[model samples]
Target: MIGWREGADRVGDLRGRLLDRVGTGTVDIDRIAGRTLAEGLDAPRAVPDRSHSTMDGYAFAAGDDYPLAVIEADVFPEDDPPELAAGEAVRIATGAPVPDSADAVLKREEAAVEDGRLTGPELDPGTYVYERGSNVAEGERLFEAGERLAPRDALLLGDLGVDEVTVRERLSVGLLATGTEIHEGRSRDLDSPMLANLVSAWGHEPTHEGSVPDDYERVESRIAALAAEHDVVVTTGGTSVGDKDYVVRALDALGEVLFHRVALRPGKPIAVADLPEHDAVAVAVPGKPVGAHAVTTLVARPLFTGESELSTVEATLSTDVGIGPAGFTYAVPVVLEDETATPLGHADSALQVYEETFDPSVLSSSTRATRADGFVLTESGLAAGDAVDVVPYPAVER
Candidate 1:
């Protein structure tokens, strides 16, 4: 099978697979902030509006107040307040541009204005108002090409008065959850919609969200429908060799199975397939919660993001940790301090995902403080200080 490792084909490698972002469109600037540098259009992006209103306080030239600014109330004569004198304090609102000839802003609260007689403490030396482009430099690189649009970034767009962000189009994703016992979307239950939360976190829109019981025909149809609609398809459960393990079968019917098992811990039995119809790719994650998370973050993440490889780090084990059974990939949660990793106990895949939140697994346990920066695979055993590779959260690497 094509895969990555010593001798296998590098099915999981993404280097050349990343798509060059095409024509850009006007997106709300707020939508593009704080996303990773690797998750954006494959080109440079220019911001729309540079100036924004910051009502906190209006700026003015040094020594240019009509009177003294009272600490609480606003400066009077809203418009054409006065010709800014060298020592005058004009009553300006929080967001109004400061008048020239005044270098300091006396916060209304900082002063006591008596019947328009402005009197306040001597201001600092430099200009007190927020300068234009002070927060964002002119031609500042708010985002390079291939950046993620997150919540914080979205707010920035608002603060900057950015109307639209020229960004790469959204990556199309097909989500298929397979399990006989797991209720389908029709159930409309809380647990059934869990994967949707994780999918949206990374910026991929779910094109086909459905479930298939242990049936090959249903799975096949789901695959066919998704292959036509999306660029990548991700299915949860049914990846193992069990009788209900129909994902491999259904995928093989559509295209070639690149690899069935990976060396990664906690997420073995992961498989990759290429569908020719939609020019899309597919990955099958095992049913176990941990397994499901592993495949999505490690394998599917880069694939959907069009990144050629995953992100990982070098870590030294601080304690002896082993899988319950030998030869199994052992994925452990670790707390990072410098180059050392402190293992979090009870790291089995069975932990509750939502109740507790770890970087890799959802848990209610206090171990949320302890995170799995990444995972390491082992066949024999490891001692404290053993050097290991820790993969970080994955996204499309631009």
Candidate 2:
């Protein structure tokens, strides 16, 4: 009987609890993408550890005027050139270390070289010179704890001489889709595949336990066994208070039910349970496709990634979206176009799969949920031009 607000608040608690039980592993920086940072990473030393020249040119004391004697040896990236004496300069290439006596670099194009002498326009000190540790200082925090590693972030870490990083081990999730209809092939078990892909996209391993029938004993045995084998167990269907809903009953008998329901339209039947016997947490999402997707993104994703902030974007609604019978909040799918969030199937909508209806009932079907790129959550019906926060699909950008 929890309200949507309370349910959403509890999501943070669930995330903290799950993350506390998760394990950590060391991974090569190249393979660390999508993994959670178990500890904050700091720059061991300043990047570009030494002062260097940024252009292929002549390096000399800024106060040295007129023709300066060019050093016999050229300074390349790997060479350590001798210090410039009075009225002396050295030919330095880009990325080459600057001699301690030099404070400025004159680009080759700007310098006049003749007969072992080089001359250039007088410039201020430090011009065209890259100072030591300019990019990052020593011991600066590079990434905070709990940050999810992105590919680019890993690349940057690699550039900083970090070959490996400690990251949270990816969890092994057991996916189960419940319903006698699916078991009998009367209805296709779409939830299993969808949930599996989502779990994979979130950097976890998904072991599809297959669809379970409505029998009480089988449900109990399947859940208990999967819980024993996996770090987390996720089931779709049999969460609501229906005569055939044996999943919840089995979970209640086998574990501690953290919460049974959330006040959310198309997804109110969500449930979470802690199975201490198997050392795993079990999450039950609604059988309806959109409902399952929403709960997984809002609740399950944070648990896996250890992210506290929900991802969302602000956009203007293109048309009036009804929210009648307003006891529950709604996840209204919409197509974004030209910075505006047009209701699905509108004249200017960007997505082609949207139907004209805004009813939550349509989301109950597995296929209809695919018709949206993302959705807007609102407690009251939205009028045209109202600004709303849209949560996109966790893996898809558009």
Candidate 3:
């Protein structure tokens, strides 16, 4: 009786639970990218650490206009400037520390020197001078616990002089694709490679255990081995209640099924389970390519990365898309063009085969997948010109 909405909610809950249970570890700044912090980071001192010049100009005390004597030496960035005495001016370059006695800097273009005397416009206090502690104050919190560090974020931490950070350990995922056809090489194993890419893109390590046949013994044995070796075990195919579906049976024998089915198209037979003996979680995705893609995006993404929601954008539908059942959610592939969502294939179709009606057999058609940018999910049919939420594939950067 689990609907798509409820299933999504459970997946979100599972994300939180897994992070709480998986624990964390310490890593150097170079290796911290894509890792979430286990603890908050507070700056012990301010950035820049001292006052300096922001312009290539001359540093001096500001006051009434004066024909002052310019110092013989020019100040560079690394120089330790001597204190400025009354009516004295020192030539300073950009990023050079301002002398303690100086309160302003005049742009070189604004000032002209003749002989030993420098003449320039009147200056205000603090002009062209970067103040100490302006960028970041001492003891300020930079990042909170559970924040995932991107490459730029990690660089920022390094700029703050942080040598190392404590982060949650990356989960190791095992991918197993099940089906007799796949095992016998009659059908190409597509889901395993796709899932591995997805897992890696989400910042986790994936170990593809390859395909297992529809036999219960093989499925059970593979699940046990994978679960014992990985933090998460993901399987594609054999999740439905059909005669050949052995994933659920194997899961029941080794652990507990948290949820069985979702009220969704293409990916309705998805299943989730937790294996206590192996300290791992198992997820089963439908074998159909589009279904497996949707399920992985909807379930595995949040489960492994701790993301609350899929990144989505609003767009206008270029054509009508027929909804499935009134209560079930539908996933429709579309090519986004200039803010308009063009639904792929013919009208009211969930599965778009090669120039024909949606057939499960054509689910492995790579050409159809390449035609669309991403898929849009909706609970009701969308008419042309209607605004809709489009969930882009992870491949799309934005």
Give all candidates' CA lDDT scores: 0.55, 0.79, 0.79
Q: Which segments of candidate 3 are over 4 A away from where they belong?
A: 1-9, 16-27, 60-73, 85-89, 100-104, 112-127, 313-315, 347-367, 387-389, 395-398
Off by over 4 Å in 1: 1-82, 85-94, 106-127, 164-172, 176-194, 201-225, 237-260, 274-277, 302-320, 323-329, 333-398
By summed lDDT, the worst window of 10 consecutive residues in model 2 runs over 345-354
Point out the higher-scoring one by lDDT: 1 or 3: 3
Candidate 3 lands at a TM-score of: 0.82
Per-residue lDDT over 1-398 for candidate 1, one digit per residue giving the tens place of the 0 to 100 score:
22224212344353124334223455556565333344333112233222222334433454444464432334432432344544445556655545445555666566665775666565564434555455665455566556556666656666555566666555566777787666443433222244455556656566557677878899888887887777677787777788878898888999877778776555667788877655667777766565556545555555444344545678897766544444444455555669886555434333324221222223212233224555554565667779977655443212
Cα distance off (Å), candidate 2, residue 175: 0.6
TM-score winner between candidates 1 and 2: 2
Steric collisions counted per model: 42, 0, 1
* TM of each candidate vs. truth: 0.55, 0.85, 0.82
Error of 2 at 373 (Å): 2.2
Q: State the weakest 10-residue window (summed lDDT) of model 3.
A: 354-363
Candidate 2 lDDT over residue span 1-398, tens digit each: 67755665565567656666779889988787778888899998887778899999999989988699997989999988787898999999999999988989999999998999888799888988998788888899989877778888866686588999987778889999899999899998777888888777777888988888998999999999999998899999998889999888888998988888876776788888888778788888889887777766665555566553657888888887666476777777777777688766343454333334456655556364467767887888777889898877654320
